[model samples]
Target: MVTVSLPTPVQPEFDTTIHRRKTRPVPVGTVTIGGGHPVVVQSMINEDTLDVDGSVAGIRRLHEIGCEIVRVTVPSMAHAKALADIKQKLESTYQRVPLVADVHHNGMKIALEVAKHVDKVRINPGLYVFEKPDAQREGYSDQEFADIGDKIRETLEPLVVSLRDQGKSMRIGVNHGSLSERMLFTYGDTPEGMVQSALEFIKICESLDFRNLVVSMKASRVPVMLAAYRLMVKRMDELGMDYPLHLGVTEAGDGEYGRIKSTAGIATLLADGIGDTIRVSLTEAPEKEIPVCYSILQALGLRKTMVEYVACPSCGRTLFNLEDVLHEVREATKHLTGLDIAVMGCIVNGPGEMADADYGYVGKQAGYIALYRGREEIKRVPEADGVQELINLIKADGRWVDP
Candidate 1:
């Protein structure tokens, strides 16, 4: 029989990396969003803006713990003017942190003032040039719609020009609960309305040669938020607009479910490679949100800020207390960054499953554990000596550092 050497069987290559959507870079102080930079973490400080010292402390607290950008509410002219003091104190007492001011409800003048003090100014499209709804009116006529559009352009131009001339950025943050009556009537209470509202403001900004903009479409409900953002991406792509998107799930309540809800929306978009900056809007302290943000990014393999622990659940084959051992390994290595360590319960799957880890502690025989350095069994030691030996092995490899 002629040996048929069927063209050597080839395994298909699969890429496991997240390919983020391409977008233009927008600067917020020292940090840059999009243009292939690392995804940013941000949050809002609930301290009253007029309380200069408290606001400064709040901002410093968040920034010290990896909050890349911090936002404050500018609800009145006093709050708007107070930002100057806030910015000054932050620079003198701490470093100058990137600041964003949230302006709402006919905030043309307020936005222009806050634009001077903050690195970025965020405006709600529906409320920036607010108009009271007519209780008995029918749908807006074509001319009526155009007239309102003109009013929006007239109101939005000054702030856009100020930010453009100063080289500052703007975020067109549209909330589901705050949609304008015009948008609600024209496009209904839906994601399409949110996308359209953003597009209208974007066009005005574009007309003035101002493109340093970030956009957010946020809702309390996950499905509505997801749909708005996905639709926004589609519309932007079709229109050749490449502004970076800021992601969040607004008003997610406190505790376990809050984190889950925020993660469900934020991580889903991030995994799809859509978001540039993110804020987890939980009802807890702003400090509490930063950890959740980093966890999501780390879990996706986007950023490695802490040690990665890979452990197998204990079963009949397990020789030792897997949970306790894993906890010990983690406590010992938690301070070390950029390392992946594995704690396996049995030899049957330990070596094979942990082949990708930097180091592993595996259950071997009765009262013994095998230490591995990336698939190579370095040594076998008593179960009691396993943790320290793993540390010794890491030291030998020059990967250990004092905590």
Candidate 2:
């Protein structure tokens, strides 16, 4: 199930070389992730799971905007029980999008009770097993480590059995910020420490013959996040395990900064063919995070879920109110997925620069604009009428679909 492969070949439209690491396929509800499935785009709800109505609304909104998977936090038994009602509500109305339960602190306990309700249960390896930092213990001896493994097996077997029986999957998610005190004391908060933390739990599941699993390594810092995933892959190979990876950059700020920061961290691993499911963690409305997830996947040629935009950087030679017109063009064309549209500031390089676009809008003179069908200049129109003219041009070419 774990095979190293050449990058999946792309059609001529995209120039890319990213062969995803081949792992066993894990089904989360109806969606298939990893094992050559198109990189899945998912988002986590900010709403608490116990607030069923609010969480359901968030999940519905995300699904409407092309989010393939939605996750909710389950911090207590009440939260775990509420997932059943939430699942039923969404299934009864909205499409039965795959739902995930993100359980921290005593996740095994939460996961056990919620196994029958959600598609997948995500447990942070860092917080799953907590030993007080001050507990008196030296470097674990072989006998002590063996006893610990047996204890883990005894604790995890019931949950593992329940998940396998219910046809649910598990994500052994690891976070840099919450590495266990044992891990911190032993490995000093390094990537190795993170991987070891996940492997501790993963080995238990494998021992119990459970196979539906996903893994994640997340950090706010890009370098640390990227290094952790790369090292994770190397270790998985050595152990001959093939669990799919969920990629993310935790607490990636908000607005443009979040988008850029997430893009750098997620895309770096994706370009190397290392991620299967990804969430762009922005400090904004959860629905707003969906577009960035798809955009990152689109840019990597892993998947295309929205419009392709080409906007030239404005300069001294630019004409017209570039800001107002650019916004207009976007408002008109944002729904045009797979069609490349160019909005340029001036003729100095607009026509040549937009050669890849199917259609373009370029500044000609003050209060005037030039349009293009690729590189050829098509027509001239007044600046005030340019937005409408460009829409008309695209519609005439049969490239426009009513949004």
Candidate 3:
């Protein structure tokens, strides 16, 4: 069997001072949501927002799993009422995790009612329309369109003013499939159209003198999402508005495909220092999105307090059940935050391969292993206790402290 040499690590371009975008900081409760604070990893709760117990339970679970901010969809008056109770419970229990109320249709009313309870409000631009296109094609025209815009403005005005007076923040979320018909008609259905829609909202907020805000220009299509945000950034720069940007690809499917698509859109913007916060919208449970968001941020070196696991794809040169062992160890240590562990099949170059790791295990003589920190061999252990022993070492090393 032919052996493949491990790939060499390319040295990163060195910079003494990391350049960060200069932005106006926006506070979401106790946590500063934007402006050079670490990129916030946010997730929406899947529980019915009207179910206070269920929503609170979901929020608590997400908090325990390291989700920083939790959003819940408030679809009606019942959900709006639950928001106050949920916020009170969360504040008493998980004091640090802020709750955002996701408002779409009737956002103005929901935003007004829930403003006092939730930390933030997410307004999706598409929900302002009262009639579907099919209904519109039969008869609706200028009057209906004008009424919709006027009603949207009227609905939004009080909440926007109240939030500003109370110093609360809001996120104006614009999705690709949900662009305002007015914007689509004026700019055409493209990135430029999306950017213009976002600008319209920004202008609205600015006119209301509401400076505490965040903006999102999301598209299910990655390229469109990227282009819209890029154009929005340029416009923000030209207009001198420094509102923090919330990044994501909306409706990014499920499983591996979702993760990849969200990562591609988020990473592209983050690498260039464009995004301020992110949410990876997936078809999966909201809880599942948290870890993926953290992973993306960790991989980008934006987040450091998570276990970094590296394992080899076993081959003919491997000894023992490498795949099974590694899989078990990975799953077992999914909650082992802030530790860097490596599991390798062979010692030939394994030690050299994982020099950046805090601790690692490599295969040796039958039922034996080499334990290491960097290139130094720390100990030899039986296969049965190898994973346990590594965990103990990491705990003792003070690399994985509880937050």
Candidate 4:
């Protein structure tokens, strides 16, 4: 039976079940994702991988920002050949961040060459070396569909064998925008079609006893992305396959819109305990995507990278400058990570809302502030003294570490 090699056990520092999914772990280089490991963060380089200097610099910046797994596009044979240099420069000078070679259309040959260099390989199986079949235009006879299946088995078996022998991992990444003609004709570009597109190759890998796999079903639309992932997990369960999932919403455009769209889709499944690793597909710079990935993980309580602040929208009930105080407190305490700080406008719902907070700053009177640790009131201090008091409270409680 194919099984996972789980990571060494670590004590749970917080309640992780809120977004924790149970799956067998897959190792990509030194990082172990799934099977109760931390939700790993990943991002891809926007540069040409064949431009070794530019790609290496981009990977260096991404590594500095906490990107655990970095993927570089290998669109053709030249890029595949570039992988050796990219891997060498990264290992010799920079940190050994796991490199994932992302390939399309000509994935079989490219993946074979790139796999020998990178730690993991990701291919959109829906279009990997697949051509639009005559069935799409002329309609399929049963034999034509069978022929397509045979082609997939032939093309993919060699790559799977190569990956298995190298002990490298592979991602059967399926995007809703790129389903094969065979899938669109049969399932009509729906989530079912996307899931079926992935399952076709997944079955092939399992048949060869290849189990170092991760699966993804990505889409630009939130509804489709969410539905496809939920359905994929159900399908995996039925097949007794516990491969970790890589979650993302593709072509999620730039700026605040990109962050919001990506977060909503990624966080939805995470809250239900479905995803194991994530990439925020913003059209922004690759390094920018890393923080967004970490923010989503931290917000879901799956990973905590920095201080978490909770604040209220100011109203007539508020006695202080709600926005300003919140901002000032954040500026002062942002350096302290894994700490929950609440800044509320007034006492009405302030204490109740921050019931679980490590420290709180809530408006108590027209110009005074109430401080708290848990639900217990620490003191009532003047408005001018609130920020300093909160800092001192953290220090007194021994939760403050020099930043």
In lDDT terms, which candidate is top?
1
| lDDT per residue (tens digit) for residues 135-249 in model 2 | 6766666676567667667767888899888878999889999987767767888999999988999988987789899999999999999999999999999989889999999
Among these predicted structures, which one has the highest TM-score?
1
**Candidate 3 Cα deviation (angstroms), residue 368:** 3.6
Model 3: weakest 10-residue lDDT segment is: 131-140
lDDT for each of the candidates?
A: 0.95, 0.86, 0.80, 0.89
Q: What overall lDDT, based on C-alpha atoms, would model 2 receive against the true structure?
A: 0.86
- The clash number for model 1 is 0
Q: List, residue by residue over 1-403, the lDDT tens digit for candidate 3.
A: 9999999999998873335567889888767766789888888888898787888899898888777878888878778988888888877876757778888765566678888887788887767434354434433367775676677667778888988988889888888897766666657788887777677667777889998888999999999999999998898899998889899999999989999999999988988888888999999888899888888888877887667888888877676689888877777676666667888888776877788887788896678878888667888889888887877776677765443
Positional deviation of 177 in candidate 4, in angstroms? 1.3
* Per-prediction tally of clashes: 0, 1, 0, 0
What is the C-alpha lDDT profile of model 1 across 173-270, one tens digit per residue? 99999999999999999999999999999999999999999999999999999999999999999999999999999999999999999999999999
TM-score of each: 0.96, 0.89, 0.83, 0.91
Task: Give candidate 1 regions above 4 Å deviation.
Answer: 1-11
**Regarding TM-score, does 1 or 3 come out ahead?**
1
Error of 3 at 168 (Å): 0.5
